[model samples]
Target: MEPAADASAQSTAERGRLLFHAGLCAGCHTAEDGAPLAGGRPIESPYGTFYASNITPDPEHGIGGWSDEDFVRALSEGVSPDGEHYYPAFPYTAFTKLTREDMLAIKAYIDDVEPVAQPNREHDLVWYADWRWPLGLWKALFFEPGTFQPVPERGDAWNRGAYLSEAAAHCAECHSPRNLFGAIIDDVRYAGADAGVEGGSTPNITPSKDQGIGSWTQDMLAFYLEIGMDPDGDFAGGAMAHVIDVGTGKLSAEDRDAIAEYILSLPPIER
Candidate 1:
């Protein structure tokens, strides 16, 4: 039997909530103790430090005055509220894979949220790094849109895993290495990453026996996702711990399992 409209709407909203956490939107956007989407957090990077902009419903600083298209452009196109190019540090590249409906739900949830009047912080960058147009062109060359492509032969759980990794969770954005211009080197896949809060390397997550988690049990992977603790009792430090504490911690157990299943299926690359 078909579900009722109210039930469907509730389900959609609940899914929107799930996606928000799975995507780790609040982890970077808001101060650790602040409200959702209020957007006054700092993002440290090798290129330069950036501050998260206000995403609340405030007309001035937040996105309260934004139209549907405006929100869509910012998320999928990496364009700012005033049409300036946003740095890839915002992770719009990963968010680009969300379906229109999913994006709309997220936007709706943001609109329905309370607004905070926090001012944004400025970036500390070199001269050439200030160019926004170049970033736009770079996006044009590498960025692709629309939702995750489903493998028809894969089960629904596996497809869900793909969606989380490719779109919402955006594992590749961090785990994958980048080229000279900071664009992800797709050829390397998940070989490893050099970007971390303090200049440490993100370990290769491929199924490689030596360089990656080839020996990790499926249960351990799921547990790590939920708690950020490894089998050796080692907890992830720096920004990764932040991801675990906020993002993955909010995900459902089933969803975390899906991510593990999809990750286990990737090619085992020697790092």
Candidate 2:
């Protein structure tokens, strides 16, 4: 019989499976018609086309050899086991806010998944971008490694929303504009961005009366996330539609409401 601790670990891993869906990890790591977590999805960026890495348990080609500490470092510090710097394209900057417990849970869940024997693809980069050493400098300038810190003055729901949006879900990766170095502009977060999504621009999710989602009620936002339906009865399309299907749609009603509440609490931005 399985030990009690082992059974508890399994249950925790199951919860982490849901967290993985909410984090949209599968969306980026899964290639078109490819085995899930086998990777090879081409993410286009200003600098180059980055192929997502395989996260399966394949010993030769995936993260099967990674320790829990190794996985945590990769997610929170953007550093691989071999000390290589991961490009910001992986969004580890935002992932840095995840707690160690959540990170371990994610690792446990990944361990439970079937291994795929797919090899990783090299990134297609612009000229003069062959070296990865520059990423260290980038991290120095913009990255702040830490877990999400709740504001003491905020309510539990608001804090939960902040944690989910800023850390777990990394919503700013798509909605916020980036600078020349591909760093998000902190001052104008969630105001909208181009080139963040494939083929089309990411829309403003801020609360500005114009251009942003200020007119949207918290309930409306929650409904949209849960079902991809707008207040006008129209269904969402494109990448957002997929996000709803794979990510937010899996969230519990309480979590969805918390996300909405936190989003609505942000200062309004017009652009």
Candidate 3:
């Protein structure tokens, strides 16, 4: 029984490992192959220069000392370990929908990994941008932290798709357009805009007869998300390619199908 327990623990650890990769947490958080969660990566944005903060298990610097509740607060509440509001650049706005279990899984994996002692990089924003204290107001205006709203009419599979799109995957973070303060303009969800790497706009995914991806069948969308290839043989480039390479590539066929279904169900707009 002891050995079985140990083996189960190891398996859970492995799941955490896979989840970290699937979530692409390292890409934005860590420098190339740097400590798993000790974030030092720089994110360039039109708003200002941003840096990914350390998320490792280091007690002082990383999340090493964070309790499960602290982890949940960070992901679900957008609060740091010491109750600081994180910028949307952290993408907790999208991550807010992740279930407590999923958040803990990510935390557990982080805990099992090595702790990097590197200090977090500071943001180089202009004075107006440096007013980090206003995030409370920003959250009130643009951020609403909550779990996913399940669609009762949808099947479990479709619900799973909703979870991926709304929570773990956070497809809208890039695909969706943002207001001046970087809050997503949900009214135009899935409408096209320049958001990929190099500031390229994502093609609309709504089922619009012309302006959106109405022409793409479920299989095609699934294939594109999986391998970055379309029926037209066009390979996704830039940030989209990175997403396929790291995040979507790790999803199961069923989950991918769920995403496709959820996307297809959206109203098509001719934007």
Candidate 4:
């Protein structure tokens, strides 16, 4: 019985670790040479530069003192412990689809990690973008907080892949173009973006031959994800390299294959 208890604890920790990587928490939360999850990294955008917030267990600077409800609200509703609104740059938009179990697992992992006393840097938004009240209207316009529901028509692997892509990896967050109002342009999702996080170009992963990864096979895409090398032998650079290193590369082969399968299944849209 004791061994079973220990195994349960270990599996939870391990699942949290994988989910953290799959969720790409470290990609934004960890700065170069900074403490893990201490978050001082700045993400470039058309609106303004948004600094990543500290997510460590530090009581003062991190979420150490936050209640479980606070954490859920923060991620699901884009609200903070103090009832403040979070900018869309945090990608809570994607996280809102996460299950309560997975969310708490992430919290468990975070709570057990080494605490760092790092304060969050304020977002440097354009003057008009500084207000948070308008966010309520924005939420009403676009936000729909819900957990992922499996598709009965699809198999378990496909459902898992969809969950990972939409709720976990949030590939569309960068890959899709955004409207002037900061909402994703659903019509052109996965059709590549001129400006993404850190103001970098994101490639289309749809199966479009000319405009997307249509030519790539599942094996090719999975290998690229595992090693950060494109079909042309060019290596991914900048933010993508970081994501591969800290996120997808650390994922299991099966998970990587699932992502590939899901990506390849998308309808190709030429831009």
Which prediction has the highest TM-score against the true structure? 4
In terms of TM-score, which candidate is stronger, 1 or 2? 2
lDDT of all predictions? 0.82, 0.90, 0.79, 0.90
Stretches of model 2 off by over 4 angstroms after superposition: 1-7
Model 4 regions lying over 4 Å from their true place:
none
Residues 1-271, model 2: lDDT tens digits: 5699888877888778877977898888999999989999998877778899999989889999999999999999999999999988887888899899888888888887899999999999897566899999988999999999999999999999999999988999899999988899999999889878664689889889889889999999999999999888999998899899889999899999999999999999875
What tens-digit string does per-residue lDDT give for candidate 3 at 184-213? 788887876665433567778888867888
1-271 per-residue lDDT for model 4 (tens digits): 6999989888888888888999999999998899999999989999899999999999999999999999989888899999988888988899998898888888888999899998889889999999999998999998889998988998877888888899989999999999888989999998988988798889888999998998999989889889999999999998889989999999999999998888899999988
For every model shown, the clashing-pair count is 0, 0, 7, 0
RMSD of each: 2.3, 1.5, 2.2, 1.1
Question: Residue 271: error of model 2 in Å?
Answer: 2.6
TM-score of each: 0.93, 0.96, 0.90, 0.97
Range of the 10 consecutive residues with the lowest summed lDDT in candidate 3: 192-201
Span of ten consecutive residues with least summed lDDT in model 1: 194-203
Clashing pairs in 2: none
User: lDDT tens string, model 1, 164-248?
Assistant: 9989988888888888788888877877887753356788888788889888877788899999999899998877888888788
Worst window of 10 by summed lDDT in candidate 2: 194-203
Better of 1 and 3 by TM-score: 1
After superposition, which runs of candidate 1 have C-alpha atoms over 4 Å from their true positions? 1-3, 32-35
